[model samples]
Each structure stands twice: as structure tokens, then as C-alpha cells.
Target: MFPTRAYSRDAEAIVALRDDLARWQVASGIVQWKPGEVTADQVRDQIAEQQWWLLRDDGAISATVRVLEDDPTIWDDLVAPGTGDALYVHGLMVRRTHRGRGLGGVMLEWVESRVRDAGRTTLRLDCAAANTSLRAYYVGLGFTELGEREFPPPYKTLARFEKPVG
Candidate 1:
């Protein structure tokens, strides 16, 4: 099994990782996270809420993913608030050095197992609508494309996907 753990502290590490990825995305023309958009305090707050998790590779934080009981802010159009029918996934990221080793799938599978263990039947997630590669990746992972959701300005439309779990 992979070394997976709930985020406890060290919010700075996660912030740095996010910023690094965001910067890379900007350089690569990926319309994802914007550099400096993720704050340490935000990460710390999520950690306090026990919504973030980490995956370690050889004692290094190689990947991270956040799981929420519900994401009404983004999925309210499809799922009502507090429905508790699905677990929402966000920020499933792998370091550049760790990219192509199936870490993303491993992290997602870990979350899917957790959702099943918690008696949830669905795993939902979203990404920028324009990111076809990522959408394809999610589809390849058994996630069905639900639809697209429009958000306020500065935020692009988001494509939502869901996978049925046991």
C-alpha cells in the first residue's frame, strides 16, 4: 500500500507544492491553478478541517488530494447541499518528478476506497472545462462526464465527473 495520511500540519509544504504546480501550469499554458492563489492559511484551515491528505514517496510528499463530504459551492447544481451521497475530490496533484508512475490513479483509488468504506456511493470531481487531457484522464478512470457548470468571473466553466463506488 502507498503511504497515505490525513494532513496534520506543515501547511507551508502543501502551499509550496501548489504554487510550484501553478507556476508550471502558467508556463505550460495550462488553464489551471494560478500562481500564488493558494495561501498557507487556506491550506492550514483545510488541514484543520481534515479535508486534505498527503501521499508520500520515499519519505517525500509526492502527491496530495483533498476530499470533501460535499462541495455545494461547485456541485450544487447537480447535488444538493449536505446530500452526503457522494464524496468530492479536489486538488489531486502529483509532483512533476512523480508524474507518470500512476500516482494520480493511486491517490484517487485510495479516496474511492475511503468513500466506499464510508458508505458513500459516488466519487465526484471537477476540472477546468478547457483541460481536455485531464477530462480524458478522468473519463479513463471510470468517471462519467456529468456536465459543465459555469461559475463567476475569473473562474472558467468547470467540467464535473462522477464515478460510482460500492
Candidate 2:
């Protein structure tokens, strides 16, 4: 198991993790619309929203993900709708060099534990519809496809999936 830690929203380490996440999105061809500026302020906003998590190994940030603990309905229209207690996962990414090192699975387990600790019963996430490999990857991890949606122009479609925490 990798050494993990929970980072506060104001942590400076998250800036690097956010850059890595944005880079991964570009490298994976998952982000069609590139932001002109990936400012620390933007990263801070994500953290201030209490949706960001930084995973570290040997005291270095290796990956990051965001958990939506508030209303699931916030993303209900953006992804497949779900009922009951659940946490929505957004922007899960690992450093390119860190990919294929089993860190993703470890981080996922971390997410599950976090959701369970929050008294939620399920975890949900979504991926671009065109990302077939990613869809299959999540399926391999036991997440079931619930539905699909087409985000407005620029982002055409996304596939939604969910899995029970317990």
C-alpha cells in the first residue's frame, strides 16, 4: 500500500497536482477545450469548494481527485442521474510517469473509504463517451454504466457510471 495523506484545501502542493492533472487530460486526449490559464487561483477554488484531494507517496504528491460531497444533483444533468446516498467523483488523474503503477486503484480505494466515512453508500463518476478505453477501465474496476449524456457544444458526450461503496 502507498503512503497517503489528506491535504487541506489551502495546501500549496495541490498546484503541482492540478498541473499534472491538466497535463494528463491533454495527454489522454480527454480535454478538447484547453484553458488558456491554469492559475493557482483556479486550483484554490476547487479546493475551497472542498472537492479536491491530493494523494502522495514518499511525501510527494502523485495524484489528485475531487469528490462532490454536496448535492448530487449539481452534476445530475452533467452525468447519469443517481438516487440515494452517493459521492460524485470529478477530475481523477495521475501523473503521466505514475500511470500503470497501480496508483489509480489505490487512489480509488482511498476514495471509496472517504465516501464510506462520510456516511455515503455509493460512488459515481463519468468519462467522455468517446473514451472507450476509459469506460472499459472503470467497468473493469466494478463500476456499472448507468447512462450517457451530451454536454453542450465542445463537450459532446459523456458516459456515467457508479459503484457501491460497501
For the record, the alpha-carbon RMSD of candidate 2 to the native fold, in angstroms, is 3.6
Candidate 1 structure quality by residue, lDDT tens digits, 1-166? 5635555566888888888998898898888789788888888888898888888767678999988998989988778899888999998889999889998999899999989999989999999998888999999999999899889977889999999998
By TM-score, who's the top model here? 1
Question: lDDT: which candidate is best?
Answer: 1
lDDT per model vs. reference: 0.87, 0.71
* lDDT string, candidate 2, 1-166, tens digits: 6334344533556666556565666887864324433466666776777777766667677777777764444356544555547787876767667889877787788889987898888888888787787899999999999877776755657788889987
- Once model 1 is optimally superposed onto the true structure by TM-score, how far is the C-alpha of residue 8 displaced, in angstroms? 4.7
lDDT of 1: 0.87
Which regions of candidate 2 fall more than 4 Å away from where they truly are?
1-39, 71-84
Model 1 worst lDDT window (10 residues): 1-10
lDDT of 1 at 156: 86
TM-score of 1: 0.95
Question: Backbone collision count in every prediction?
Answer: 0, 0
